[model samples]
Every structure is written in structure tokens, then in C-alpha cells.
Target: MNKKLLLICALISIAAAVGYYFSKGPERISVTQYKVAQGEVKASIANTRVGTVKACRRAYLAPAIGGNVAQLYVKEGDKVKSQQLLLKVWNDDLTAQLILHKAQIKANQATAKQFCEIAAGTERDSQRLSRLKKYDRIISEEQLDRAATKARADRAQCQAAQVAIEIARAKLEIVNTDIERTLVRAPFDGTVAEINAELGEYVTPSPPGIPTLPPIDLLDISCLYVSAPIDEVDAPQVKVGMSACVSLDAFAKKRCSGTVSRIAPYVLEKEKQARTVEVEVKLSDAKDLQELLPGYSADIEVLLASKEKALRVPTEAVLENNQVLLITADGVLEQRQFKPGLANWNFIEVLSGLKEGDALVLSVGREGVEPGAYVRVEE
Candidate 1:
């Protein structure tokens, strides 16, 4: 009887050991967690591809009539005003022509004055002869007729001289137009970004239907904007005057605030690339405008809608079906379903089934992070 009782006791001890081992539970996982809080949530869209920082006004300048570059008034990085002379092609011939036209005009004016004086004297003589013939008959009819013919001829010569003066003036105007064609002027206030010709170098205007490098590149850095492309799916949500943020790859720390200024009327369909619509965002009053330049790589985020002081969760913390893995006070993972409102890449608005001050598992992809599993929140 004592041996049988001891055997029963041994089996009972083995059973208790097995139960203790089995009840120890699954292994605990260390995971990152985010505490729910009231914050701003935005519905925004970002560029699908890289965008560019562009000037509000950029101009590629070249002379209308090409010739040897006679003078370069501006160098790269020179600030210029509207109508400021930038360059002048070789125009010594045109200048000479202009001087000749001026001289011809002066000469024609002098000749016109001389001829008009002669015409005035001739008319007086003809009037005296006509009075003598009509009232006193002191001159022969043939002599009076000859006098009238001379007066008429003088008057016609005077008119011809005046027309000659006008012709000379018209020639002067033509010369001036040609001279302007050889000169390049700033179309707006900007900085000279490039100069393709030096003194005495031949520069040719671009032929029709063929593009060539411009002699000067002007950029209006005082006003700058960013042009980016968003996927066609997100294009409809963007509109003019919407607030936006611009980020330049060169200025990583700065996010220049801007607004939607324009949207392209058509979508771009590039081979092997997703269809995208071009959008332009203009800076309102950026203090860093001076530092930006055209052609700088940039990205933009257009805010479609925003909610302030809303129950928000890190977007990554939310899982499939609007669910999130919440960390219970006892360090156990609990799955909770919530209705979401506005969402963005950074945060999501929690419309229901959540509250401020709740802890959620941020690293939901970690092993053993399933609901009902024990968790150790990483400090």
C-alpha cells in the first residue's frame, strides 16, 4: 500500500510539472508603439515623379538678326532691369547707314527750304504779272502765260523736295529698326543666367522650326515656383489656390509654403511612365527666394483637406480593414477596428473606436505582434 501511494504521488508531481510548462504562454515580442494624440491630419497628394524648381518668368534670349557679337553688356549672374541692354551684335554697318540717313534728311530739309523760298518768290512774280495783264495790260499775253508756267513748275519742285525729305526720314526709321534687331534687351527684370557669345563671336538666330542654344538665359528669381507632376488619379483633387508645400532636394531642411497656381489642361503620357498631370505651385512669400534657382530638383505636396485637433494615429500603425493593434495596459496586444476620416502619408484621422492617449503598436509587422499575444514595448 505505501509503494502504490508513492507511485500515485510521483505521477501527480509529473502532471503538475507538465501543466506549469504548458501555461507559461507564447514568447513576448518587443515592438515600437505610438501613443494616440490629438493632432492635425491632412489629405494630400505628392508628385509621382521628380519635379523642378522653375522661375515664374524665364526667357531664352537671342537677337532677331544674327551677326558677330559686337558687345556683351551682361555676364552670367548679372541683375538686370526691364529693357536693359544685354548684348549687341556687330552693327557698325547699320550705324553707318543710320548716320547716312540722318545726313540725307538734313540735306533734303535744306533743299526743301530753298525750293519753297524760290516757289514763294515765283508766286509773287506771277501775281504781279496777272494783275498787270488784267488791270493795265502792260505785258504781252505770251509773257504772262510763260510767267504762270514758271510759277507752277517752281511749286511742283518744292513739293517734290518735301517728299524727298519724307523719304529720307522713312529710310532713317528703317535703319533704326534694323539696328534694334541686332541688339538684345531684357524683356523683364531678371538675372542673366547665361551668355553664349563673347565679343566678336558670330551668333546666329535660330532658324524657323529649328531650335538653337540662346545667346542669353534670363531668369526672374524674384518670383519662383515649382512645377511637379501628380498621378492622373490624384489630379482631380488638386485645384488652383490650394495650399501646398514645396521641398527641394538641395534644401532638404526647408519646406517652402506655396499655393496651387496652375494645373495643366492635359495629362502627360510618356512611354513606360505613368500618366501624370503637371501642376504648378507658386511661392507666396518665401524668405529663401533668393537661394532658389531654376532647374533645381523639387517635390511638392498639395493639401486637399485638413482637420485640426483630430484624434490621429500614425498611418503605419493602422492595418487592414481600418484595424490597429492596440497595446493594452497589461502589455497585451488587442485588435481594434476604427472608422477613419482624412488620411495622409504621415497620419490618419481616427473618427471612431479610438481615443487620445491610447497606445498602439507601431511596428505591426514584427513577429509575435498578433492580437492576444504578450508584448514588451520598447523604450
Candidate 2:
């Protein structure tokens, strides 16, 4: 009877040990989580590739008539005003021609004065002879006729001299125009970005269909814009006057506000690139544009829609089928499907099936994180 009791107790002890081992439950997987909250969510699009920060007005300046650079009034980084002289090509011959024309005009004016005086004297003599012949018979008809003919001829000579003056003035204008063609002036208020020609350097006009470097590069930094390429699908949604934000690679922490100013009417088809349409965004903030420079690599985000106070979550936390994982009060992973509204690269709006203060699993890719699995949330 003692042996039987000991065996029964041993059997019960073994069974209890097995039950305890099986009841311990699955191990908890460590995970990171984000609590649901109310914040701003925006729907937007960005450039498909890198974009360029460009000036609103940029001019590649060169003299219309090629010649040796005579004077350089501006150097790189010099600020200039509209119509200010930036450079002058060699125009000594033109200037000399201008001076000659002026001198010729003066000479013609003097000649005109002398001829007119002679004409006036001849007319007076003709009148006197006419009166003498008619009344006193002191002057003969031949003398009167000769005096009248001399008067008419002198008047004609005087008119010809006056015409010569006008011709000289016209010639002077032509020389002045030629001189202007040899000069390079700023088309608008800007800073000189580059100067390819130096004093005494001979610069030539670009040949037709072949572009060459201009002698001067002028950029209006006061007004700036970003030119970026957007995918063809997104281009149709973009319109002029839409709000935008510009981020440059050089200024990582700064973002400038802008508005869409233009969109290309056609798409660009490149062999290696996706079909894209060019878009321009004008920077609206004067203070933010002070540090921006042309040629800086940039990116642009055009806002399409937004929700100011939407329940949102980090975009990375959302999983397949618009679902997100959350830890229940009992510490088990729960997959919940939600309706999403506005979404961007950073955040997504939660429309339904999620509430504020619910901690969503951010580390959805972590091992052992799935529906019904126990998780240990990281603080």
C-alpha cells in the first residue's frame, strides 16, 4: 500500500510539471511604436529627378558686332542697373566717324548761313534794280533780269547747303547706331556672374546654329525660381499659382515657399529618362531667397491638398492593405485596417478604424511581429 501511494504522487507531480511548462505562452518580440495623433497631412508631388535653382532673368550678353574689347566696366559679382554699360568693344573708328559727321554738320551750317546772306543781298539788289528800271530808268532791263536770276540761284544754293546739314546729321545717327552695337549693356538690374572676355580680347559672334560662350553672364538674383521636371502623370494636376516649397541641397535646413509660375505645354521624351514636363516655381519669400544662388541643385514639393487637424501616423508605420499593427492592452500585436485620406512621404491621414492615442507598431518589419504575437513596446 505504501508503494502504490508513492507512484500515484509521482505521476501527479510529472503531470503538473508538464502543464506549467506549456502555460508559459510565446516569447515577446521587441518593437518600436508611434502613438496616433492629430497633425497636418498634405498631399503633394515632388520632382522625379534633381532640379535647378535659376534666376527669373538671366542674360548671356555679347556685343552685337564682334570686335576687340575696349573697356570692361564690370567684373564678376558686380551689381549693375538696367541699361548700365557692362563692356565696350573697340569702336574708335565709329567714334571718329561720328566726330567727322558733327564737324561736317557744323561746316554745312556755316555754309548755309553764308549762302543765305548772299541770297538776301542779291534779293535786295534785284528789288532795287527793278524799282530803278521801272521808275527812274537808271537801271536797264538786262541788269534787273541778271539781278533776279542771281537771287534765285543763291536761294537754291542756300537750300542745298541746308539739305547737306540734314544729310550729315543722318550719317551721324548711323555711326552712333554702329557704336551702340559694339557695346554690351545690362538689360535689367542684375549681378555680373561671369566675364569671358578681357580688355583687348577679340570676341566673335556666335555662328548660326552653333552656340558659344557669351562674353558676359548676367543674373537677376533679386527674383529667383526653381525649374524642376515632374512626371507626365503629375504634370496635369499642377497649375499656375499653386503653393509650393523649395529645398536646396546646399541649404539642408532651409525651405523656401513659392508658387507655381509656369508649366510646360509639352512633355520631354528622353531615351534614358521618363517622360516629364518642366515646371517653374517662383520664390515668394524675399528673406529666404537671399542665400539662394543660381545653379544650386534643388527640389520642389507642390502641395495639392491638405488637412489641418487629421488623425495621422508616420507613413512608414502603415503596412499592406492600408493596415497598421498595434499592441493591445495585453501586449499582443493587432492588425487593423483603416481608411487613409491625404498622404505624403512623411505622414498619412487616418479616416477610420484608428483613434488618437493608440500606439501603432512602427517596426512592422521586425521579426515575430504579426497578428496575435506578443510584443514588448520600446519606450
Model 2 pairs in collision: none
Models 1 onward score TM values of 0.90, 0.88
Residue 360, model 2: Cα distance from true site in angstroms: 2.2
- Cα lDDT tens digits for candidate 1, 1-379: 9999999999999999989988986568999999999989999999999999888899999999879998899889999999999999988999999999999999999999999999999989999998888787668989888888999999999999999999999999999999999999999999998888888888988898999899999998889888999999999999999999888878766564788999999999985658999999988776757588889999999999998888999999989999999899888999999999999999999989998899999999887779999998889
Candidate 2 residue lDDT tens string, 42-102: 9999999899999889999999988999999998999999999999999999999999999
Best-fitting candidate, scored by TM-score = 1
Ten-residue segment with the worst summed lDDT in candidate 1? 248-257
